[model samples]
Target chain A: MTAAALSLSKIVAGHDGHVSISDVTLAVPAGARVAVIGANGAGKSTLLKTIAGELPPLGGQMRRCATCARMGYLPQSATVDTRFPVSVYEFVAMGVWNHVGLFRRLGPAVRQRIDAALDRTGLAALARRPIGALSGGQLQRARFARLMLQDAALLLLDEPFAGVDRPTREALMALIDGWHAEGRTCLVVLHDLDLVRQRFEWCLSVDDGHAQLTPTAELLALRPTADGAAAARHAFLRDALRA
Target chain B: MSWLLDPFDFAFMRGALAACVALSLGAAPVGVFMLLRRMSLMGDAISHAILPGAALGYLAAGLSLGAMTLGGVAAGVLVALAAGLVARRSALREDASLAAFYLISLAIGVLLVSLKSRNIDLLHVLFGSVLSLDRDALLLIAGIATASLFGLAALYRPLVIECADPDYLRQAGGPGALVHLGFLLLAVLNLVAGFHALGTLMAVGIMVLPAASARLLCERLDSMLALAVGNALAGSIGGLLLSYHLDVPAGPAVVLSLGLIYVVVLAFTALRPRPILTSEVTA
Candidate 1:
C-alpha cells in the first residue's frame, strides 16, 4: 500500500470545543481522492477544518506524513467578501503567497504559472475584471485557478460545488482529477453521491458523531437501508443529545 | 489665480496647508482600508480614544507637539488592543468593547483638560490651532506622512487579502489576524498624527469623509485612493483659504469642506448612476 499522506488518530473535532464528530481515526493514502459525504450538518466541514488546521481537533492527533509539505484549503464561498476591489488576475495570483510570501516579487516564471492556471480554469478572459463582477460559476472557476497555483501536496475543499452550476462543477471536478493525477491528496466535502461514486476511490462518511473511512463502494453499501432509516434517525437524535 | 496664490504668501497659512495636505496623504489611505473593512466607525472610536492621552500629555508638557503625539499614539493603540482582546477572550463583541473604552477615554480626557488648563487652552486642544502650526509641528506632520506612505506600501498585499478574503489568507498560512492587527496599528498611528492638525474631535473626519466621497465616484481601488487624496487636498486648500479670509476656525472648516465634497459626490452619483456600482451590493 502507498504511504499515508495524512492520518487522524482517534480524533474528536468540532467548532469552539463543541464536539460534532468524534472517534474518527483514518489514514488517507498519498494521491487518494477521498470523497467526504454525510447527512446535513454531519461535521464534514469540521473534519476538513481540523485537517486544514483552521480548527484544532478537540481530542486526538492529525499528522501529515513527510511527503505532505504544503496544504491548500478552499473554504465555503460564503466566507469570502468578493466586493473588496481586486481584479480576477490579482486575486488568482494570491495563491503564490506560500512560495513568494510577503515582499518577494513575483518572478516571470510565477507570473507565467498564474497565467497558465487562469487559462486552464477558463478565467483568462475575465482576468482583468474585478472579482465582484464575476457570476457565481465564474467565481468558483477563479477559485479553482487560484487553487491550481497553490501547488500544495494536500488539498482540502469545503462544499466547493455548493452554488456552482453543473458546467462549473464538472470543470472543477476535472481540475481535481488533474491534481490527483499529479499525486496530490484531495479531501473533498461533497453532497453529490453520484459524483462521489463516479470519481472517488476512497470515501469518508461522517454520521451520528462517528466518521468511517472505507472504499467508496463499500461505504455506499453500508449506508442505512430503507428499513433501518428510522432506527438510524433515533440513534442520531440520541447522539446529538449526548453531544 | 491671485486669490488662490495669495494664501501661500503668508508663512503660517503655508504651514497650515502643508500640515493638512500631509495629514490627508497619510490618513486618507488608512481611511480607505477602514472603509473597505466596514470599520468606518472604528475610526471614530479610535479618535475619541486619543483624547485622554493628549490631555495627559498637555497636563504634563503643556502643548508640546511631540509629547502630545506620543501620548495619543499610545492611548489609541492601547484602546484598540484592549478592545480586540476583550472581544476575543470574552463574550463582548468588538464594537461594544470599543464603545465602552472610547467613551471612558473621552470622559476622562475632558475632565483632565477642565481640571488644569485655561478655557482658551481647552479650546485649542479640542478644535486645534491650525493657523498657528510652527516649524516643529510641520516637521512632525511631514515625517508621519512619509512613514505612513511607506508603511501602506509594505502592508498593501497582505492588507488587501485580509480585507477581501480573510479566510483564504488564514488558510494559505499568511497570518491574516496579525496583518489585521498591524493595519489597526497603522490606523491608530495616522489618527494620532491627524489629531495634531484636526484635533481629536474632528481628526477622523479628515480621514473618513474624503474616502467615503471617493468610493462614490470610482470602482477601482487605486482610482478610489487617488480621488480620496485629491479630495482631501482640495478641501484642505479651500478650507484653509476660507478660514483665512472669513476668519473662521481652520479644523472645522477643513472637515466641512470634505463633508461638502461628499454631499456633492453623493448628489452627482444619484443624478447619473454608474453602470457598475461595485460598492452597492457585495458577496
Candidate 2:
C-alpha cells in the first residue's frame, strides 16, 4: 500500500530469441529487505539485472526513486579483476567514479565518504593493500565497502553470501542488517532460505518464471535463528565503528 | 664486439641493421598488447594476409616500394575487416576466420607472384635481404615506426581497457566500435612497416617474440611495453651482426634471436619464486 521505493512493470528478459524470464512484475516499499528465492535459473538473476539497468527489459518499465543518489548492485561474480595493479582504496574510490569524472581530484568530503565506506565495511586497516592480494572474504568486503560509499537508498545484491565461509557470511549479514537499520531498502537474491527467514522480513519466491510472495515467518519455521544474541565480538566491532 | 664493428664497415650491413631496429621497436608494443589480449596468433594471421597485398602492389607499379607497401597495408586492413565481419555475422569463431584469411592470402600471394613476375626475388621476400633496403625504404619504415609509438601513447588507456574487457566499455556508453577500428588500423600500419625487414611471416615473429618474452618478465602493462621495446632493439642489433657474420637472412636471424630471448626469460621466470606473494599488499 505504501509508495514502492522501486517498481517493475511487466518485465521480459531473455537471450537468443527465447525468454529467460518474462511477465515479471514487482514493487518494494522503502526500507524493505526483499529476498528473491528460487531453485536455480528461475530468472531471479535476470530480474535483478533488468532492475539494475544492466540488461534492457524486453517489454516492460522499471522505476527507482529519483532521489536515490546511492544505488548499489553486486553481481553474481566480481565485475573487474582485483589482480590488476590497483589498490583497495583506489578500487573503492572507483565506486564513486560516476560521481567524479576521471580527471577530477577527490576533495576532503569525498575523501571522508571513502574513509567511512571502508571503515563501515571493516576494511579500513587493509586500505593500503593491492586488491590482488586480498582473500575472497576480504574482496567481497571491499566491494561492499564501495557500495556503502555510494550511500544509495536502494541496494540490489545477487547472491552475496555464495562461496563465503559460514562465519564470514554471518558477519556480512550483520553488516546488511546494520544497513537495514539505517532505513535503506535492499533486494538480495539468496539461496539460503534460513537466513532469508531470520534476517529478511519479506520474501519473494520465484519458480517457473513466476514469483509468489511469501510471509517471512513461514520461511523462518524451517530454521529459526541459531543464536539469539549476535556474535558479541563481531557485533561490538561493527557497532563501535558507528560511534 | 670487433666482429660487430667489422660488419658495420659495409653499407649493406648498415641498411640491414637499420631495418632490424625499425621493425623491432615499432612492432613490439603492438605485439605485446596483441599477446596480452590473447590475439598473438592473430598477429601471425594478419602478417600472412599482407603478403598478397604486397604482391599485388608490386604487380601494379612494378618494384616501387611505396606501391608495394601501400598495397600490403590495404590488403592487411581488408583481411582484418573481413575476419571481423565473418566473426560477427556467423557462428564461425575468431580463430576460424583468422585461419581462413591467412591461408587464402598465402595461396593468392603465391599465385599472384607466379602470374605477375616469374623472377620474384626469393631473397627479398623470404629471408629479407636487408642489403636491398634503399634510402627511401629506410626513411619510410623509420617514419612509420615513430608514428606507431606516438599512436600507442595517445590511445593507451582505451586500448588497455579494450584488451582487458570490452564489456566495460559497452556499459560506459563509450564508442567501442571506434576503439576496435583504431586497433585494427594500428595493426595494419605495424604490419606494413614490418613487411620491409621480416617480410610477411617472419616480420610478425619479430614483433611477437620480444613482446611475448617481455610479458613473461613484467607484471604490469606499462612494464611489459618497456621491456618489449628494449628487447626488440636488442634483438635487432644482435640479429643484424649474426646475419652478417654467418651470411644468413637478416629477418630470420632477428626472429631467432627474439625467440632465444623468450626462452631465456621464460626459464628465468620459472626459476624464480613469485615475488608478489610475500609482498602481499594489504588494502
Q: Who wins the DockQ comparison? A: 1
Residue B166's lDDT within candidate 2 is: 45
* Runs with alpha carbons beyond 4 Å of true place in candidate 2: A1-5, A29-33, A64-73, A78-155, A170-186, A212-243, B9-19, B64-67, B84-93, B118-123, B126-131, B162-166, B172-177, B273-283
lDDT per residue as tens, model 2, A1-243: 666788768878765656777776777888888888766777788878777777877888878876544577787887565445456787677666456543457889899999988887778887877666777888888878767766778888899988787777877898789889998988899877557766888876666666555457654543344334323322332233234
User: Once model 2 is optimally superposed onto the true structure by TM-score, how far is the C-alpha of residue B240 displaced, in angstroms?
Assistant: 1.2
Instruction: For candidate 2, write residues B164-267 as lDDT tens digits.
Output: 44454444434567867877777788887887767776768767888888877765667788899889988778888788789777778888888888899999
Expressed as tens digits, the lDDT of each residue in A1-243 for candidate 1 is 899999899999998669999988889999999988777787888888888888988898889987676888888755567777788998899888878988889999999999999999988888888888888778888888888898999998988999877888998999999999999999999877678778999877788888867786664454433133433633443354345
Best by TM-score: 1
Task: Kindly list the interface RMSD, in angstroms, of each predicted candidate in the order they appear.
Answer: 4.1, 4.9
lDDT on C-alpha atoms for all candidate structures = 0.84, 0.75
DockQ of 1: 0.46
Candidate 2, after superposition: displacement of residue B168 in Å? 4.0
